[model samples]
Structure formats: C-alpha cells, structure tokens
Target: MHRIIFATGNEGKMKEIRMILKDLDCQVLSMKEAGIEADIVEDGTTFEENAIIKAKAIMELSGNIVLADDSGLEVDAMDKAPGVYSARFMGEDTSYDIKNNYILEQLKGLPEEKRSARFVSVIACAFPDGRIFTTRGVFEGFIGDKISGENGFGYDPIFWVPEFGCTSAELPPEVKNAVSHRGKALGSMKEKLKEML
Candidate 1:
C-alpha cells in the first residue's frame, strides 16, 4: 500500500481523517508518525492556499503523498474576523474555552439568526511528482450562545446545527463524520485518492 502523510499534529483532526479514510487502500500517517519535523509557515490568506502550502512543504521533505487541511470558523457577525486565523484568534497559546467564551460575549445580545457561522475545510493533496489536488467542504450553522458539547474540538461546541437542533460537537462521531466540514472534504479527497491509487 502507498504511504500517505497527513500534515497535522492535532490528534483530533488525525482521528477524524483516519476514521473517514479507514477503508482506503493506503497507510495514513501523521507527520510525526512518518518522522517528519519542520516548521511549515502557512502564510496564505485563504484556506485553500494554506492547505496547499503545508501539503507541498511536507511533500518536498518526505517525497511522499502529503495531505494538509486548513479549516476555520467564519462568523458573519464578526465579519469573518477569524476566518484564516482561527487557530490564532485569541492568540496561539490561548485555550479554546477562552476563545469560545470570547466569541459568545461578542454575540451575547444578538439573536440566533444574526449569529450565523460556517466551518470551512480545504484539503490539499500534493504528490511527489509536483501535482496537487484540492477539495473544499463547508458546514453551515449559527453560533450557539454557550459551549455545549464535548465530542468535538475547536469551534465545534459553539457551532449550532440547525438541522440537528444541536451543536456540531454534540453529534456522534459517525453522524458528525457524515456531515462535518472536515468529513465532507476528506470524503471527497478519498474518492480522488481511490482513482489515483
């Protein structure tokens, strides 16, 4: 089976990726699992650009198929203030509790409709032969007034799913994987990999 390195140190994301792509005929490994260590700078202004940057950077070092995803929460109320900077929103070291609370405080008085937000995931797969494939997935929802779920990471607890009448974090892993932004993106990427592999 071909070895594929996913460029991310976040275990939460790794779990989701592994679960979604488990049926693929390839070995999916994290950068650390593949013995890759580097400070890749994601200077792109958009999710797609950032994903490409990381994928290409890792592929250059490993000479293997590298996958990277840049995802974030875009809130319409905040005019997408933390779109590309979601990880660094309240500062890189700040906890998500603080970040989630801060967002809640910002939209305290606003109605649910005004708290519109969406999660975006852009996946980029870079081959050793200098070819790159990209896919995007977006999950639409409004922001909840409080952090409510424990099953998800990042901004998931605050992302309300209107269709489910709950937060994204509240959904089960199987359910979330079937409807999440990362799941959707990874699902699409899996098809591309099936053809390429």
Candidate 2:
C-alpha cells in the first residue's frame, strides 16, 4: 500500500483521518509515527495557505507524500473571528475547555438565531515533485447556548446541528464522519488520489 504522512500531532484528527481513509489503497501515518517533529510556522492569512505550508514543510523534510489540514470554527456574530487562530484563540497553550469556555462567554446572552457559526476545513497534499493539491469543506450550523457533549475536541460541543437535534460532539463517529468538514474534504481528496495513483 502507498504510505502518506499526515502532518499533525493531534491524535483525534489522526484517528478521524484514518477512519475516513480506511478503505483506500493507502495507509495514513501521523508525523510522530513517521519520526517527523518539525514545527512549521502557520503565518498564513487563510486556511489553505497554512495547510499548504505545513504539507510542504513535511514533504521537504521527509521527501514523502504529505497531507496537512487546517480547520476552525467561524462565528458569524464575531465577524468570523477565531478563524485561522481557532486553536490559539485563548493562547497557544490553552486547553480545549478554556477555549470553549471563552467562546461561550463571548456569545453569552446572544439570541439563538444570531449565534450562527460554521466549521471550515482545508486539506493540502504535497508531493515530492513540488506538486500540491487542496480541497475545502464546510459544515454549517449554529453555536449552542452551552456545551453539550464530551466526545469531540475543539468546538464540537458548541456546534449544534438542528436536524440532528444535537451537537456535533454528541453524534456518533459514523454520523459525524458523514457530515463533518474534515470528512468531506478527505472524501474529495480520496477521489483525487485515485486519479493520481
């Protein structure tokens, strides 16, 4: 099987990607497993740029195919704030709980209808020949009044799905994968991979 290195240390993301790509003819390996720990600076203004930066950095270091993703919650009420900086919204070292709490406090007392938000994911794949490919996916929803689940990382708990009557974090793996931004992006990438290989 072809081996592709994913440039992320987040185990949750790693697990999700593995599940999404399980049926493919390639094996996805995390940077840690690939013995790569280089920290690529994410100074780009957009998610796509940041994802490309990461993937390219890893490809250069390992000289292997690499995929990197940059995803975040964009709140309409906040004017799309915490977009690229979602992970470091509170601070570089802030815990998920603290970040979640901060977001909740910011949206406190806002009307439910005005609490619109969406999760955006951009995945970039870099090849050893300096070729790059990218795909984007978005999951539209509103922020809940309060945190509701404990299964997911980042802002999953506050991201409510009206049709499902639950937060993204409350959905089971299969359901979440069917509609999640990362899943959609990876699914599209898989099609591209099939064509390329």
Candidate 3:
C-alpha cells in the first residue's frame, strides 16, 4: 500500500487522521511508524505558514508525501488572540485546564454572543517533487464560561458549537471527526488525496 507520512508526534492527532483516511487505499503513518522523528519549530505567524513549515521539513527528510497541520482557536473577543499560539497559550508545559481557565477569565462577564470564537485548521500536504497543496477549515462557535465534557483535547471542552448545543468535547468521536475543523479540512482534501495516491 502507498504510505502517507503524517508528521505529528501527538497520538490523538495521528489517530484522528488515520480514522479519517481508513477507507482510502493508502495508509497513513505517524512519524514513529515511518521511523522518522523531528522536532520542528512552529514559529510561523499563521496556521498555513506553520503547517507548511512542518510539512516541508518532514518531506525533505523522508522524501515522501507528508501532511502537516496547524490549528488553533481564534476568539473574536480576544482580538483573535492565541491564533497561532493556541498550543502554547499558557506556555508549552501548561495544562489545558489552566489554559482553558485563562481563556475563560479573559472573556468573563461577556454574553454568549460576545464569546464568539472559531477553531481554524490549516493542512499542508508536501510532495517530494517540490509540490504542495494547502487547505483550510473553520469551525464557528462560542467559548463557554467553563469547561464541559470528557472528550477531545485542547480547547474542545470550552468550544461551544451553537449548532450542536454542546461543546466539541461532548460530541462522540465519529460526530466530532465529521464536524471538527481538522475533519472538514481532511474531508475537503480527501478527493485530492485520492487523486494523488
């Protein structure tokens, strides 16, 4: 089977990507699976840039088609803060509980409408032939006053989807994968992947 290198160390992200592509003829392999390890510096100012930086680095090293993504929560009330900094909003080692609480405090006393936010995902697929395809997905919603649900990672607990009437964390894996920012981007890129594979 054709191998698609997914350049991420996060197992949660790797699992989600694999689940998304389970039906494809190709196989998605994590960095470890591919016997490649990288410590990429995600210093880009935007999601697309960071994704590209990561994708290119891995592709250059492995000489394979590599997919890399950078996603984050963009809160309108916070002037779109923590956009590219979502992973390290409260420092890299800080727990999500602390980070989530910090974000909640920033939007305290504000109504739901004022707490509008969105999760943005940018995916970069880099080929060894110096070719790249990039796609973006946005999940619109609001940030709740406190965390909820036991599912998902990062800001999922506080991300309230008005359409679902629940936080992303409250949704089942299948449901979340079908509607998440990463899911949308991966879905959009599915056909492209099929074509490329």
Candidate 4:
C-alpha cells in the first residue's frame, strides 16, 4: 500500500486528518510518526497558498503523498480580520480561551445574523513525482457568545452552526467530521486520492 503523510505537529489536526482519510487504502502517518521534523513557515496570504507551501515543503523530505492544510475562521462582522490569521489571532502562544473570549467580545451585543462567520480550509496533496492537487472547504455559521464543548481545536468552540443548533466543538466527532471545513475538503479529495493511489 502507498503511504500518505500528513504534515502537521498539532495532535488535534493530525487526528482529524487521519479520521478524514481513514478509509484510504494507505498508511496515514503524521510527520512525527513518519520520523520527520521540519519547520515549515506559513507566510502565505491565502489558505490555498499556505497549504501548497507546506505540502511542497514536506514532500521534498517525506517522498510520500504529503498532505497539508491551512484553515481559519472568517467572521463577517470583523471584516474577516482573522481569516488567514486565525491561528495567530492573539499571538501564537495565546490560549484558545483568550481567542474565544476575544471573538465574543468583538461580537458583543450583535445579533446572531451579524455574527455570521465561516471556517475555511484549503488542503493540498503533493506527490514525490511533482503532482499536486488542492481542494477547498468552507463551513458556514455564526460565532457564538460563549465557548461550548471541548471536542475540537481552533475556533471550533465559538463557531455556531445554524443547521446543528450548536457550536462546532459540541458536535460529535462523526457529525463534526461530516460538516467541518477540513472534512469537506478531505471528502472532496477522496476520489482524487483513490485515483492517485
């Protein structure tokens, strides 16, 4: 079987990716599991660009099907202030509690409609033979006033999905994976991956 390498050190992200691509008839290994430690700087201005950068960077070393993703929360009220900067909204080392609080503060007093936001994820798959494929996914919802649940990472705690009537973090793993931006992107890439493999 072919090997698929997810280029990330974040445990949450690694787990999510594995779950998204679990059915593939190949090995899904994180960078650490694949025995690679490369500092990939994310300086791109867009999600797709960042994902491509990481995927290409890792593909050089992994020599396997390297998968990378760049995702963030884009709030309409904030004019998408945290679109590409979601991960570093309150500095790289700040806690998600602070991040969630900051978002709540920004949307204070605003109605749910104005609090509309979306989570965007761009996933890139790069092969050792120079073939690269990318897919994008967006989760539409509003930001909640309070952080609820601890099921997901990043802005999940504050992202409220109207369809689900709850925060993304509150949804079960299977449910979240079916509606999450990462899930959408990974799902869209499933056929491509099958063909590639």
Best by lDDT: 1
TM-score preference between candidates 2 and 4, better one: 2
Model 3 spans > 4 angstroms off: none
Off by over 4 Å in 2: none
What lDDT score belongs to each candidate, Candidate 1 first?
Answer: 0.95, 0.91, 0.91, 0.90
Best by TM-score: 1
For every model shown, what is its TM-score relative to the native structure? Answer: 0.99, 0.98, 0.97, 0.97
Span of 10 residues, lowest total lDDT, candidate 4? 14-23
Taking all chains together, the TM-score of candidate 3 against the true structure is: 0.97
User: lDDT tens string, model 1, 1-197?
Assistant: 99999999999999999999999999999999999999988899999999999999999999999999999999999998689999999799999999999999999999988999999999999999999999999999999988999999999999999999999999999999999999999999999999998
Q: Model 3, 84: alpha-carbon shift in Å?
A: 0.7
Candidate 4 error regions (>4 Å) = none
- Compared with the true structure, what per-residue lDDT tens digits does model 3 show for residues 52-166? 9999999999988899999999999999988999998879999999999999999999988999999999999998999999999999999997899887888999999888899
- Per-residue C-alpha lDDT of model 2 across residues 1-197, encoded as one tens digit per residue: 78899999999999899999898898789999999989788999999999999999999999999999999999999999899999888788988778877788989999989999999999999999989999999999999988888767889998998889999999998889889999899999988888986
What lDDT tens digits, residue by residue, belong to model 4 across residues 37-77? Answer: 99888999999999999999999987888999899999999
Q: So what's the TM-score on candidate 1?
A: 0.99
lDDT of 4: 0.90
Which has the better lDDT: candidate 3, or candidate 4?
Answer: 3
